[model samples]
Target: MATPGTLVLAGTPIGRVEDASPRLARELAEADVVAAEDTRRLKRLTTELGVTVGGRIVSYFEGNESQRTPALLEELEAGRRVLLVTDAGMPSVSDPGYRLVAAAVAADVPVTTVPGPSAVLAALAVSGLPVDRFCFEGFLPRKQGERARRLAALAGEERTMVFFEAPHRTEAALAAMAEAWGDDRAAAVCRELTKTHEEVRRGPLAELAAWASDGVRGEVTVVVAGAGPEPGVAADDDSLRAAVDEREAAGMTRKEAIVEVARSAGVPRRVVYNLVHSKGPR
Candidate 1:
C-alpha cells in the first residue's frame, strides 16, 4: 500500500544563484533521490544557495545516462521521489534528460516540472528580434559540411531563430550562417548571459562574424531575424519550389532554400518544405 512515486524535473538558475526558485530549494532538500548533471557543480550550487541536500546525490550525465537510467527508474518504482536537474536550465534541452523522460513516459511514471530561468528565453527576451514566433535550434553540427547543411535547412525561416554555440566556434558558425541566411540578416550575440560579464551584440550576420573573428569568450547564445518577404516571385507552389531549387543548386540547403523561397513566395515555410520534399518535381 505504497504511494506511487513522482519524477520532478527542476530548472536551475543559468547564472546568479539568487534566481533559484523556492520550489527548487524545497525539492533539493526533500526529494528521495536527486540526479544531477554534475555532482561537483551541484555541491557548489547547494553551497551558494545555503541549502542542505537531504536526498541521495547521484551523477546523471551524457556519459553515464544509459547505464544509470534503469537504476533511477528502480528508485521511482520503489515509490521514491526522484528529482532531475541539470547544471543549468531545465533538463533535456541540449543537455541530459531526454532518454529518462521518454522511458518514464513509456512506463507511465508521473512526471512534473519546476520551471525557472532559461538561457533560450533570456536570450530571446534581450535579442531585439521577434519573439512572438521563434525557433530554438540548440547547437548546430560541428563539421563544416554538416553545419552548412543544417544552416541551409533553416535559410528561409521567417521566425526568429535561437542557437547555442561554443565561443571557439561562434565566429565560424556566424560566418556560415551569414552565407546561408544572407550577410544582411539581423542577429544578436549574447555572451555570458546573466553573469557579471554578460554582453549582447546586435547587428547583421556579417558584422557579428567579423567581431567574433577576433575571438570571444564565455557561453554564447545567438538569435537571428527571419527572412523578410521577397519581391517579384509569384506566390505559387511551382515558383516557390523553383526558387528553393535555385538556391539549393547554388549551394544552399534544401531547408535553407525552402525558407528563402517561402519568404519570397509569400507562403508558410512549412508549405515550401512539404512541396520541396513531395516525391516529384512540380
Candidate 2:
C-alpha cells in the first residue's frame, strides 16, 4: 500500500542553527515537497544539517502565501509528504504556513509538527517577570500612532505581554510603551538570542527605551511586567473630590477626570462619580 499523504509544519532555529532538532533534519531530507518562507534560508539550513533535500522545493512567503498554499495543498493531496518551514521559529507563529496548514486540515490530510526553538518562550523564561499568565502580542503595527493606540488599549491588561520588534524601531516602540504603560513598568529586551552575541537587557521601560535610543541590532523580543495592583483608596470623601477636581482642572473631561481619580485612588468610577455629584461641585 502507498504511504498516506501528510503535512508537516516544522519549527526552524530562531537564532543559532545548532538549535535545530534532529526530527527537523530528518523531515527535511525525506519530505516529498518542501515549502519554505525563504528558499535561500531553507537551502542554507539543509546544507548546515548535511541533509540533502530529496523532494521538490518551493517558496511560500507572505507575498506569495496565497498563491502558494493551494499549490502546496495540491501536492499534499497527491500523496506527497509536504513539509512547511519558515525563515525562523515555528512556521505560522508570526510567519507563513498557517493557511497551508489549515487547508490540509480541512482536506483531512494528516498534520504534524516538529517542535523546536521559540523566541517568545525563551524571552518569557529569562524575563524576571511573571510568566504564569501571559499573551503573545506578536509584532505591533508599524505606524507610530496606531502602535501607540494599540499599546494604550492594553494599559489595563493584567497579563504579562510578549512582543516581537525590529531592531531599528525598538526604541520608538519602547518609548510608546512607556507612555502608555508608565515609565516605571519593568521589561526586558532580549536580542540575538542563542547566538554568540546574545544579550538580555532588563530594567524599567524608560531605561530600556534610553538604551535602544543609541541604536539596537539583531532580532528582538520584549517581555513586559503586567499591570501592578491598584493603589489604596482615598481616606475620605474630601480627598476623593480633591483628586477628581485636580484631574478635571488639568483639562480632562469629566468622565476622563473621574476615571483618572478612580484608577489613582483605587475606587470605582461610578462611586467617584456619585460622590462628585452628591457633593455638587467644588
Candidate 3:
C-alpha cells in the first residue's frame, strides 16, 4: 500500500507581500501540488517573493471547493504533498480549504499548517479592546434580516467580537451593529490592514457607522467590545417573556430569543427557557 500524502494549509499575507515568510516561499516551491484560492493572486505573491514554484497549480476557490475537494483528496491519498493557500490570511478561515482539509483528515492523510499573517488577530490587537477573551465572527450575513437576527443572538456575548466586512457593505454593517449593540458601544474599524493605506478608527459604534457613510475601501475588519457584566436589572417574569417575544418576532429562533433575554436580563438561560415554555412558576 502506498503511503498517504500530507495536506499543508499555508497562510498567505493578508496584505503587503513583504510579510510573506521564507518558509512559505520554500513550501510553495516544494509542494507536489499547489491549491490556491486565486491562482492569479498566487502568481503575484510568488513573483513578489521572488520564488518559482515548479508544482502544478490548481484553482480551489469557493465556487469549485465542493467539486474539487475529491480530486485534491485523491492527490493526497496518492502520496502527493499538496499545499493550500488562500488569497489572504489562512485557508479554511472564511476561505476555501476546510472541505479539502476535512476530507484529508477523514482519510487519515497528515494535515499540517504554516502559520502566517491573520487579519483576525491583527485587528484585535489594533482595536485596543479586551483581547483576553474574543471571538472571531468572520463575516456577518449580507441580508439585513439575517444579519439582524445574527446580531440579536450575540447581544449578550461577553467576549470581544471580531468581524470581517467588504468595503461596500461596511457602512451598512456598522449601522446594523450600532443599532443592535447600541450606539455608544465601543468598537474599531480596521481597513486595508498591513497595506500602505492601512487605517484603524476607534470610537462608538454610531460614530464608526457615520464615518463609514463617507465610504470605506479595501479589506475591512471590525472589532467590538463585548457587553459589560449583566445589569442584573430587576426585571419581572412578564418583562422577560416580553423581551424574548420581541426577539422571536424579529426572526430569531425561540431558543435564541430565550438566550438573548436571559443574557440581557442577567438571568440564567435555563430560567428564561423554562419561563417561556411554561415550566417555571410565572
Error of 1 at 278 (Å): 40
Q: Would you list the C-alpha lDDT of every candidate in the order shown?
A: 0.87, 0.86, 0.88
lDDT of 2 at 132: 86
lDDT of 3 by residue, 1-282 (tens): 679999999989998888888889999999999999999999999999989997999999999999999999999999999999999999999999889988998999999999999999999999877788999998999999999999999998989899999999999999998889777677899999999999999877778999999999999999988876334333588788888878888999997787656655544566777778894533
Between candidates 1 and 3, the one scoring higher on lDDT is 3
Q: How many pairs in model 3 have backbone atoms within 3 A of each other, for residues 3 or more apart or on separate chains, i.e. clashes?
A: 0
All candidates: TM-score: 0.81, 0.80, 0.81
What RMSD does model 2 have? 8.8
Query: For model 1, how does the per-residue alpha-carbon lDDT over 10-108 read when each residue is reduced to its tens digit?
Result: 999988899999999999999999999999999999998888999899999999999999999888878999999999999999999998888888878
Residue-level error in angstroms, candidate 2, position 5: 1.6
> Candidate 1, clashing residue pairs?
152-256, 153-255, 153-256, 155-256, 156-259, 156-260
Stretches off by above 4 angstroms in model 3 are 229-282
Task: Please report how far candidate 1 places residue 40 from its true position, in Å.
Answer: 0.5
What does each candidate score in C-alpha RMSD?
9.9, 8.8, 10.6
Task: List candidate 1 segments past 4 Å from native.
Answer: 229-282
Give Cα distance to truth, residue 21, candidate 2, Å.
1.2
User: What local lDDT score does residue 106 receive in model 2, on the 0 to 100 scale?
Assistant: 94
Give me the candidate number with maximum lDDT.
Answer: 3
